[model samples]
Target: MKGNRRSEMSVTEMFSYIQGFLSADQDVREDIRKVVQNLEQTAREILTLLQSVHQPSGFKEIPSKCAKARELFSTVRTQMAELKTKFPVEQYYRFHEHWRFVLQRLAFLAAFVVYLENETLVTREEVAQILGIEVVREKGFHLDVEDFLAGVLIMASELSRLAVNSVTAGDYSRPLRISNFINELDSGFRLLNLKNDPLRKRYDGLKYDVKKIEEVVYDVSIRGLAKEPESGGDK
Candidate 1:
């Protein structure tokens, strides 16, 4: 009889605990909202800086711009770490949806810089590492794959502009290189089974970017300018 009574008391306590969990803490939500606001503002600033990446003379300015973006990202990571302590994985996603755009922009800015310098793709793992977040999705809050992919898509748009700008700046070979990079990126994207959402929409936008680059290349080629070697000169 004593054992039975103890079990009944445990059950009662478990129900109360569950009730508390069901309500959640409003204060935490508000705190996360405040953090999101700060992050959004910083993200906007970073986006502005990243715009320079596509300009004719903007490539040289990217390293410094990226530095500023990284500093803001550090602040974001601190807020995320705090939120992680108070919430579970799903809760993280709830708050993450609010500011994930900022993360994408920041990642895109950094990754684009790397691409400009090295003519290589910046892997998701590398972006997450630079952003000071975990790429793994074992249990708790982690970097979202969709967010990273969106950032990559954003880079595609920037590259499209860079392609046009390169020609305007008289660097035809850079657009050809960019065209190849974007083509490979597009092929890689095709392998992914995307849902009918923003990802797919962004993926569709890639075709336009490709067309713009191709037009640039074709115009150059048709004018008997295809065989010229790339001149190593700063724009």
Candidate 2:
């Protein structure tokens, strides 16, 4: 009889513990959702600002747009820091799905700003720094490599569209530069042994971006719209 009583007590205690755990999980998820919503809002604002690059006169204002976007990242940094504290570091992956999409968007925004400023791919370290997160997982919340690559793929697509718009904007030289950038980016992506399905799918879309940019460049070159490479150098 005592053994059965003990068994009943153990079962009750186990369920009590599970109930508490589930409650805490729900609370944490709710908090994370609120924070992610804020992050998404910031991302939309930055995306809107950057979309101006598609306009005929937008190319000339890129520096200003990038500067404005840089300031907004400070807000993102604060929100991310708050988000990091909502759950234990060990539970990162447990709740990662809640914020993964927002983080990817933030990564893309940072990459877009860097590309506009220097026409170079933003490093993982740079993206993490811009987002005010860690590069190493042990240090706490960090940017996943897959997220960074996804962002780069997104940037490649955006650049391909820019190649088309640059022509309409009377900037023929920009399409050639974008073509070279996307071609090299495609080559780099080919070397990664990707396993993540979403990332792999994104990488697959890169070829279409490459094709579009190439078409823009070809149209420019065949029509004598491209600038001639300088003596002793082909760009």
Q: Which candidate is the best by TM-score?
A: 2
Steric clash count of candidate 2 = 0
lDDT of 1 by residue, 66-96 (tens): 6776776677667667656655666666667
Q: Which regions of candidate 2 fall more than 4 Å away from where they truly are? A: 228-235
List the global CA lDDT of all models. Answer: 0.75, 0.89
The count of backbone overlaps in candidate 1 is: 0
Candidate 2, which ten residues in sequence have the lowest lDDT sum?
226-235
Candidate 1's error at 230, in angstroms?
4.9
